[model samples]
Target: MGMLNTLLQAVSSAPIGGAIGAGIAAIGAGIGIGMIGKSACESIARQPEAASDIRGSMILTAAFIEGVCLFAVIAGLLAVLK
Candidate 1:
């Protein structure tokens, strides 16, 4: 238990921890966006006539994912600064 606590403290105290967390979060967001784009492309290829609708949905989903990632970065910054 003591060792675990020490490890936790060390991680929380590291100067680059927050930045690393933010970077990881951004990576996740990027992956999500990539997947969305891939799916959208596949969908359009399968049904060319529905390209517009697929694009619209993909844009909306990407925007939402970006928003969440932005919020997480802000929160991480705030926590680190505090």
Candidate 2:
């Protein structure tokens, strides 16, 4: 019974941890997207003729990163609400 109570207390106090996780996920996503944009721009500058191709691939990669970050945030919300 004592262990059970302790577990419950821990769970109840986990919202802070969940919020931190979400924040970290957001930061990571921002960094990832920024890097992609930076590299794409550099590539385009080096080869203006291939700008179209570089832009297309950059957009796709950024979208994927955003999706993963979204999932992570949702998971964090679930943890906080649990």
Candidate 3:
């Protein structure tokens, strides 16, 4: 897509720090999400009756993590632009 191409071009021209920051943000988010999933699974396994509530909480927490990750990535990209 045109947007992808533009992003690629901008990245290619940018300094390394922003790219690294973005990568770290993505990696951290992945780890956080993974931990969340693992914990949720364990909790569900240990308490089947509370599965619905745990699942809901897990999803909400994951969404919040993702939102934060998105902001971090954007900040990194904005640094790249600068």
Candidate 4:
């Protein structure tokens, strides 16, 4: 029981979880952005006339994802620091 409690305490006190979460969030955002860009390019290729609109929408969506990722990173950092 004593050893178990010590192990639990050590695990709970470490900031590894927060760091891992932050890293995951960043990676997820990168993948999401990449997908958006890829799909936008494909759409543009299929409809060259709508390339401008597709590019604009893709940029907007990527910005939104980036904003959310930024917030996630900040929250994770706070958790680790606190």
Candidate that would win on TM-score: 2
lDDT per residue as tens, model 3, 1-82: 9999999987776757887989999999999999999999999999999999999999999999999999989988898878
In model 4, which range of ten residues has the least summed lDDT? 10-19
Task: Give one digit per residue, the lDDT tens place, for model 1 in 27-77.
Answer: 999999999999999999999999999999999999999999998887777
lDDT of each: 0.90, 0.95, 0.93, 0.92
What's the residue-level lDDT of 32 in candidate 2? 100
What is the Å distance of residue 56 in model 2 from its true position? 0.4
Ranking by TM-score: 2, 4, 3, 1
Model 2: per-residue Cα lDDT at residue 31: 100
Residue-level error in angstroms, candidate 3, position 61:
0.6
lDDT of 1: 0.90
Candidate 1 displacement at residue 43 in angstroms:
0.6
Residue 1 in model 1: shift from native, Å? 16
Pairs that clash in candidate 1: none
* Superposed Cα deviation of residue 29, candidate 2 (Å): 0.3
lDDT string, candidate 4, 26-63, tens digits: 99999999999999989999999999999999999999
Instruction: TM-score each candidate.
Output: 0.79, 0.88, 0.80, 0.85
Over all chains combined, what TM-score does candidate 3 have?
0.80
Q: Highest lDDT: give the candidate number.
A: 2
